[model samples]
Target: MGEVKDVPLLSELLKDSPKNWGKWGADDEVGSLNYLTSLEVIRGVGMVRSGKVFTLQVPMGAPEGDPIWPGRRTAQRVNVMDHSHYQCGKGPHFPGELHYADDMMIMYLQGSTQYDALGHVWYDDQIYNGFEAETTTGGMTKASVLPIAEKGVVGRGVLIDMARYRLKNVLDRGETFDHEDLMAAAAQQGVEIKKHDILIIRTGFIGSFYTMPSDNFYDNFVEPGLTYSPELVSWFKDMEIPNLVTDTIANEVTIDPVSGIALPLHSALMRNLGVAFTEITILDELADDCAADGQWAFLYVAAPLKVVGGSGAPVNPVVIK
Candidate 1:
């Protein structure tokens, strides 16, 4: 209801991050609050508590197969140019200089398992829930996605290892995970559904998306367990979970018969219902930790890049044990 502003803002102080340096062109690297000025700031979003959470990358770094989508934008090697400061003299901005960096791998990130930002989807040109398509662009990072306070996703998380559920045993990489398989996985794990809970699906497709046929461009039919039926999407959107994450590239896959293309659930959830989604992330690292400790609920965190109207982001989420 207010307005996004670009007043003299305190610039960001860098800490030698190989990726994304150009924060105000180096002249403000003293970690001083001065550069914070003139940085185009917005703080409508409440203080993020996920500051203490964990992350599981699914569509991260072009996991395995052909990570491109309808646009055919092939995933380039993750390359970040300079990161240090390029001090060009001094000024009231204390540590003054241009904080610059090229070759920066910038991806608009979402919160947990890394779902699509509210700006990522829309139906017939309109954004999610009650957003207008024409007016949803170029927002400040802090104000990019829905405010952490408004629709912040802090809820119970359940993992359904569809592959294991279907095979009736632990699965190896590249195993097929279908809808029927997901149910079995839930039954085996004794996991139940509840309101406001985030669902983390494991199809064991992580490795494949990263190995073997490296350029396995997402095709509709014949793709293994990496996909699901359109009904699954409809069901999830209807269930109205806060969000749905996964240990795979995309949640539901290219079901030629189901949705007639790749990314079925994406359209169903994002375009239709505005359900946040995450791509590839690192989740299995804590699988045993979670199972051993019987910990399903975690203080999840997803701090995506504030790419201002960007599609998605690369995140380093941490889950507090």
Candidate 2:
């Protein structure tokens, strides 16, 4: 919520932004999520004037097709009882009907709409708050996704709506925007990025994909996202925003310009800053609703699956205006 002033670029801030290793504590697991205090939740609740809810999750099997991520299988669902078995009264005991539809699913938790827990990424053999990498290989003993799932993420959610404001719903693949762009868009929308807010950026990626669904296109092609810049990281740290969700696979540009690291922003946020991220979120409906009503900030409610010791989990986040 501070004024936008000139500051060192990401490259410089990357060297200076102190690691939040022990800011919360050496044993801290939830990372920046600690920012979501009860008062913050109360602030979010007060924003819900219309009581309209918008779910921000893309379906588990999205685009009406095969899996988009390579090597990850599509979500599988199977009935526990077949038609023949159910008809023969082989199902569990019941008075009138002896049949029931019981089903199970085998899914890749991070395949669709998901949250990248603090344990999901690391750098220099360290995770958030200096947890070792070896411990995370088997399963994260520290900073596991369970804690986040158990303690729901609730706060004021703000949508940047970059696609509609800047690209006119035609964002190009591999295009990247930086901190200035984010601030400019927010200013244009008359929305301020508040502390401890769940910041959601709409790049129009998910919206575009729905129109032309292609596994190959999504899996291999470049995509538009926030540029992996130190300036952007600095802004996040300065703003104290806890969670970030975007309509892109990777929150940052696919290729880093300076270090050439594949996902430098992930390392900066998850590894260095303890900030959580959600990717491939469905934000078109939220964007449209915000544009129609001019209410950009609202109450955000998201609960990650309580997958014990898991790196990440699928999430269904809802925004209420």
Candidate 3:
């Protein structure tokens, strides 16, 4: 088989795709998140009926290890100081005989449930808002996650459980879905995907990662996700979706089957339409509750850590029904 570098470039695949560059302004780093105004927050609040809550972050340092992108490792937490240290007379002792435990984590910013910076992906030597890609050198001077973390994401969220809709516990590897499929799943759940809604899709992919053997899960790893197409790109533009949260590592298929390009939607949507992307989320609990209550819409609130110059930041998104 031919190598990945032989495929068409992302710029070529998304050549005519719609772009929201300078839509908010040249200085805007948060991109489509600007759609989440107070009015949208009010709209989100209206969806809270029973007041059940769900937190959508996967445990970092899980015993089974995290399901991360191939080249990256799971988060590793180390105890800087603990009871063991105190017992060994190695830990600092505060006045009044106070003792405390401390810890630190080593991880890729995108290792867990996280929000990707607008500058996370790009092509043609440019990032979102037409910022020169060179600005990303040394540490995201243009569209880092800091701006997004400060603004925050709060709005209506709709869950489209594609696995349940397709009568599968988990989608087959490389399975693909598109905008029409999303609408169909929403229709099945009796919900409408409105403008500025935080679109959260559950493929049951992450849930499988915990049960299946790690080697099997990573072998020929192609995640089932939204495929790239001009029409699908247009739909995202028309819908004005602020954020896309999914149970997969990459928000879309790892490699576009048709174009043989990797993550074309990252360019067509995030880098062009300026939509926010949240990946590696724990959505089974949220999806189960939504399925049980027949209520798919809810208030989605997330604040990624304000890591300056970070390409992305971990987030524990909260969903209120």
Candidate 4:
């Protein structure tokens, strides 16, 4: 691929951003994910020279202090054996001869490190590919997260360690950065953004979660994330990035800098361009490994649960260098 040169600003791209509604096709459901072609997977495979792997998913049930989002439940595990008829030394088996344990969990699919499906966000009653925003109660016929889960996300992953480049423990809450900032971080790390790549940005926020009070971290702390700007969205579109992963709750700044719009990044990327997001990922270890080896590109892989009609699903993403 060639270097990205002189890309237009968000202001210039907004007019055409909406025009992308039918660019893939009227019946297209996989939006920007179309960029993750077989060629891209080949390129990703070529990046795995080190053979070291890093898991990007935070541990399940790790965020147990309080609910981050209202109505979103923390994961809970229960021993199902209690309810089972089979018991040790009972009717099903002889004493100490056979023992079995069963367990079950209830959780919000998007509660942890997860990908937001194309139907996860929308603008003014429309979803990706101009699908009308209507579905039967808790189910969806189109734009559900299942397509992504089925296809699986595989590509070259590039890490832009903003926290390390900026020399901050963590980017302060409410801090916003633009395209230039991202480019600078990539340049500083001797990496290049390529077409169809899964971009991972490290704010070092997830590391802070362990050191700070849960209440302070969730309630009082504003998060540092990408700026919700037309320029940033334009850059992603121009680069043909299929998916984004960030070590922050909201990929964009917590509070929208733009007036009247809440999550412009989500709207532009997910709703309009079909770009997916894996938010609240743990990237500190990956960033550290990249920095140590001086290699920022790796093979990224993620498989979401095949939840029918789900808007989003928790993901266990891995980066192999």
Per lDDT, the best of the predicted structures is 3
What is candidate 4's CA lDDT for residue 21?
Answer: 67
lDDT of 2 by residue, 1-321 (tens): 122343333444466655678998888888888899999999999999989989877776533753234467767776686666767867677798656567787787787788877878765677788889887977778888888898889999999988887757857777778878887999999999887889899988876767774754565567777767657788889888789889887777776644445667887887788888888788888888889889999999898999888988888898889
Candidate 1: deviation at residue 5, Å?
A: 47
Q: Lowest-scoring 10 consecutive residues by lDDT in candidate 2?
A: 1-10
lDDT of 4 by residue, 1-321 (tens): 122344433334354564356877787767788898999999999998968989988777753542244347678777666425553434356577565677798888888888887878765667777788885246867888898999899999999999999998788877778878988989989998887889889998877877777767777546788866667777888988889889987687765655434456787788788888888798888888888989999999997888899888988898988
Compose the digit string of candidate 3's lDDT tens values, residues 152-252. Answer: 99999999999999999889899999999999999999999999999999999988999888888999999999999899999999999989999999999
Runs off by more than 4 Å, candidate 2 = 1-17, 66-68, 82-84
Question: What lDDT would candidate 1 get against the real structure?
Answer: 0.45
| Best of the two (1, 4) by lDDT | 4
- Superposition error at 321 for model 1 (Å): 4.1
- lDDT against the true structure, per candidate, is 0.45, 0.79, 0.92, 0.78
- Per-candidate alpha-carbon RMSD to the true structure: 15.6, 5.6, 1.2, 6.4
Clash numbers, per candidate: 50, 2, 0, 2
RMSD over all Cα atoms, model 4: 6.4
Return the lDDT, model 2, position 252.
70
In order of appearance, the predictions have TM-scores of 0.57, 0.90, 0.98, 0.89
TM-score of model number 1: 0.57
What's the ranking of the predictions by lDDT, best on top? Answer: 3, 2, 4, 1
